[model samples]
Target: MGEQPILEMKNVHSGYGSIKALKGVSMKVMPGEIVAMIGANGAGKSTTLMTICGIIKATAGEVWYDGKKINKLNPEKLPTMGLCQVPEGRRIFPRLTVEENLILGAFHRKDKEQIKKDIQYSYDLFPRLGERRRQEGGTLSGGEQQMLAIARALMTKPKVLLLDEPSLGLAPIIIQQIFDIIKDVNKKDGTTILVVEQNANLALQAATRGYVMETGEITLEDKASALLENPKIREAYLGE
Candidate 1:
């Protein structure tokens, strides 16, 4: 068998109330690889990430992290287990300073000194954030808020990073910058990433492999290059 996946979701089924958001969806991310799940609106991409993060409990099937079953794991305990997520919207604290918002991301850890270093590292990654360290998170522009979101998630020092719609509502230039930083994080930190994005082109460009989801189920799985060249993918997601 191939090396075990760092993160795996097997036949996961989850939804809100009676509305099924995911229908037995299954996928995996190998160590040090960037995996993207791409689909249109209401196609269950965001739901998949939320389920994996335990923010939305799975009603059936299993989620595994480093070979440990984690479907039943509490969402609050995930960060300590080296799993972190940057949700779709940049949900930084509106009233808190940028620095304070980032510090909150390390709430589960007790390494005070190391936390300080990581904060500086985050600032280095996004100098805009460093310049606005004392500014309220709500005061930053849309692009800056998105940067802070990614930076905060990095503070957790995750082994696996789950990103939902990182390219949403930003200018092309800012989106490119975000994806570039994402690849950098994967390479430098060796963080296994499972990103859910509506921008299939960008996602495929950033990932090693990708899954195509439709109406709550994955319909295609292929290497990123293959998916990017596929005629169907081009017509549907890449806007060819």
Candidate 2:
């Protein structure tokens, strides 16, 4: 691991109005590693992701990405800095073609040749997306849309990918497939990934390190294998 983390949140605090979602939450993701944030509903997992992506601003502490303080940067600037987020719910444009959606992801880039190459790369990664390139985004299945969402994020050529609940609402087999692709992306592209998931087992399997959050606090942080073996984790989150 590098001396400086690729992404870091130091005692971050944020929420909607008076409701504080994150209370002194701190975490870090090193280069080329998959780090997971696992937590129950309302535990601030999603908030943390949004905060880091600049969708939500932190009232306290700082968010550092690639040695720059990004806590104050607007959301639009994040993609340009090699930070891309696939938000929850697979938010694809319903009326747009699959290719159009992917193209929108690279709107900040001016290099047409590079964009073309990235589009091809994304298509190669998910053949289904290529097959449905002309189809409207709403026509795809939930699993296919999830794939599209990921593919669109990848079109930005992000150095650090922040994935929020990629497995939500998908079939078990599809979830497995998505996780496999995520691992492949990390291995092949060296993209640092920070994933927030409710599926503890799946997240741990894909990540090298994991953190367990509860009620806006991280109660456990350890190696994925260690967390998987923990009695409390198994009983509380793993349903063991």
- Give all candidate RMSDs, comma-separated: 1.2, 0.9
- Residue range 1-240, candidate 2, lDDT tens digits: 788899999999999999988899888899999999998888999999999987888999999999999999988888999999999999999899999999999988899999999999988989989999999999999999999999999989899999999999999999999999999999999999999999999999999999999888777899999999999999998999
lDDT of 1 by residue, 1-240 (tens): 139999999999999999999999989889999999999899999989889888889999999998899989889888888989999888999999999999999988899999999999999989999999999999999999999999999889899999989989999999999999999999898988999999999999999999999999999999999999999999999999
Structure candidate 1, residue pairs in collision: none
Listed in order, each prediction's TM-score against the native is 0.97, 0.98
Q: Name the runs in model 2 displaced over 4 angstroms.
A: none
Model 1 has how many clashing residue pairs? 0
Root-mean-square deviation of candidate 2: 0.9
